[model samples]
Target: MREETFKKRKPKIVVIGGGTGLPVILKSLKEKDADITAIVTVADDGGSSGVLRRSFNAVPPGDLRNVLTALSEIPELQREIFQYRFKSDDRNLDGHTIGNLIISAMTDMHGNIYEAIQLLTKLMRVRGHVFPAAEEPLNLHAQYVDGSTQTGESKIPKKGKKIDKVSVTCVEKERPVKASRKVISAIMNADLVVLGPGSLFTSILPNIMIPDIGDALIETEAKVVYISNIMTQLGETEELNDADHVRVLHKHVGGKFVDIALTNIGIVPEDYIEQEINEEYLLQVEHDFKGLKAEVPMVISDDFLLLTEKSVYHNGEKVAEEIFKTAFNSQRKIKKYL
Candidate 1:
């Protein structure tokens, strides 16, 4: 009876980070009917999001927009329209995306981003919650191994230097970036907290470095799982193995919070990625299973790669299955103890 009851209850899963990968896992989790909350990074100061952040003095809506669309139950056409980007000859709105503009407008109307996201999520019929790591736009600062420093997410990778550490600050003032009460609560109360298949430095760490969120991650009773990226990124995670990723995360969070790591053991076909076309993927991430086992309590290795259209991605369905399986077994153990 207890086993049956546990199975009936939806697992409260909180996924942290930003970038394209976050959404892929999110959409899959939604399909599984997990109670989801996405804590996204707002430290982006790049391209259309950067322009809007400067113009409107709003939270960078790019990451939040993608998360919203991913968990939304709205019609496919409306979702497309929400994600549509303008490519007009006109300079003003040429590179602007419709979703970014809408989110910015909504932020203005509500006078706060948290409320704006709540309202927007309701309208989109989002399956779960989407909260920005901070209410305001955050500026990402990186200290490279060579003692060099850089600000701004887009420009950080351009330096071509090894990043030793990264931190976030509010754009308007020299103050600590804060995650809202709800964001912290989500982490504290979650059944499982999943990190990345996204950019290690820019996307995932930005959210983790926020004091309250980082602390909650460390203090939370939930099992934390990290889905390691399939390919190595040029500047951020160049030549980094799966364990190196976990070490960076632990170094930032100040604790060995990641209980399990989901690593991709599948191989990408050689000459599969066009260098010019897919500049982001520098090389396939070499697996160091021993090093990975040292970082986390348990390592889950699988063929978690999805290759399509000359791009490499996590096979979201398979990853989500592993996530729920982990969460379910973890929950069942807790229930047994009770």
Candidate 2:
């Protein structure tokens, strides 16, 4: 391709997270010309993914599946095929998402999860890339409020105990599959690196837990921005406000991992609040990012969340839009080679 063609391309953006939050960001960012690489955490151990991981000795595929669907250009048919879940009744297909089974099978065929994801990305014609944080099947270990340890990522929240801290454990030598050279290069060369609106412990932090990945993020010259969660997670971040979130993140990856923090300042409508109370089990609180005294400046906006009928999350487009605005503003003032 010509240099002009490439230069006309949007800035490269690497978003790190897993599960629903990642896709929401991806979906919004894809609208822009930016190149997106979603580096997903693979420590999930629940649902159809849990069954496959235990049976086949594979990295949990639920998060990967969600990311794939989010980036995929295909219509409802392909997405439905990928997201199809079997019933819990007696059958060989029970409790498994079609995407998980397909990914597991691809991993078996290619003998690696990385290769399988690459293949699927090509098949789906994703706008950007999606890679697992590590090649090995990993487990998340958490120390609870009572000082008890929980082993699985899925089980940690359900335990109903406050999480004291969290860490990732690999089945093999702790060398984190060395984040794809392309990913590291992207981070090193990126104009902006976005963390997440995902789960603090399970989704977002897992990426930083990888030593090499964390090192790359820390060493990268790009401006780093973290999008804080809007509501408190039941078990993981029970009473955590914006400042508490940053403190926990600092404790894990040290204070230098972030450059800026973007948080929602909007209020949920009263009807929306009632719906959240009855269905989603979430309560909105004022995020205290001001108290963090972070090195990077913090930006707050009235980016209201979109609530779904499923009683879970709505789209994160408003937050993503604010993030892009902040990034663009930052880049305009700071020269690329500076």
Candidate 3:
């Protein structure tokens, strides 16, 4: 009976980030015995999301749309339909995805992105909570090593300069950027807070740059784990290693907040990545065990690579297993202390 009860216990996890990587992790976590809350970045100002952000002054929907689909219990066909993008000569609708448009319309109806996401989470039967990091769209600013700064998520990396640091400012309003109403509470309540398998400067840092969300992460009793990216990114993390990733995050948060670091030791075939895949991926991230040890208390290094379609990604199932185990172990230790 004790074993059965242990198996049935659910760990509350809050995943924070945006971009292509966020949804991939969310999809895998949905299959686990974990209650999940996704705190997504709204600092996107590129692609279809950017166009909508400019047109409707709504929170960029692309990341939120992907997150919604990843956690939704809806049928596969419906999910495909929601994600479907139109290709046409018509300039107005050609680049916009069905999900983004729907989210834009919903934001208009609800008068805010937070409420829009909440209602859609139910309508689509999303298994967990999804909240925007900020209520309004935000602009990302990156300071380069040369003392130059660039703004806009899509525009930052395009400058091809090494970034020193990044920050976020309110886009639609001049007021200080704020996390969505539920974001702080969710982080404080989580059993584990997962940072990223996403872009370091653009996707992950933008969420943490928000004052309240960063504070919540620091104050939360939950263990913080970073799913270090497997490959280095061009114009972003060009030559960064696993430890550099942790160090940068630590600096942004003002202290060593991360308890664990998940490092990928899997090998990627040198010639396997196709041209499209190489666009962002410069090389495999070099390992820096000594540096990682200096930042985090624990490091779990393993073959977390998933290669397919001429690209590299984290093995989501493997990652979810480790995450659940960590959360469960921490809970057991806490209970013993109590």
lDDT of each: 0.89, 0.76, 0.89
Off by over 4 Å in 2: 1-7, 173-181, 269-274, 277-280, 292-295, 312-315, 329-338
**Per-model TM values vs. the true structure:** 0.96, 0.88, 0.95
Best by TM-score: 1
By TM-score, the candidates rank as 1, 3, 2
Q: How do the residues 313-337 of candidate 2 rate in per-residue lDDT, one tens digit apiece?
A: 5356776676666555544222232
Q: Model 2, 29: alpha-carbon shift in Å?
A: 1.3
Could you tell which candidate, 1 or 2, scores higher by lDDT?
1
Residue range 1-338, candidate 1, lDDT tens digits: 97788687788888999999999999988898678899999988888999999998889899999999999999999999999999999989999999999999999998988999999999999998888888988888999999999999999999999999998888866676788658888887788999987999999999998888899899888999999999889889997999999999999888799999999999988868654267887888889999988989999999998988768989999999999888766663332111
Clashing residue pairs, candidate 3? Answer: none
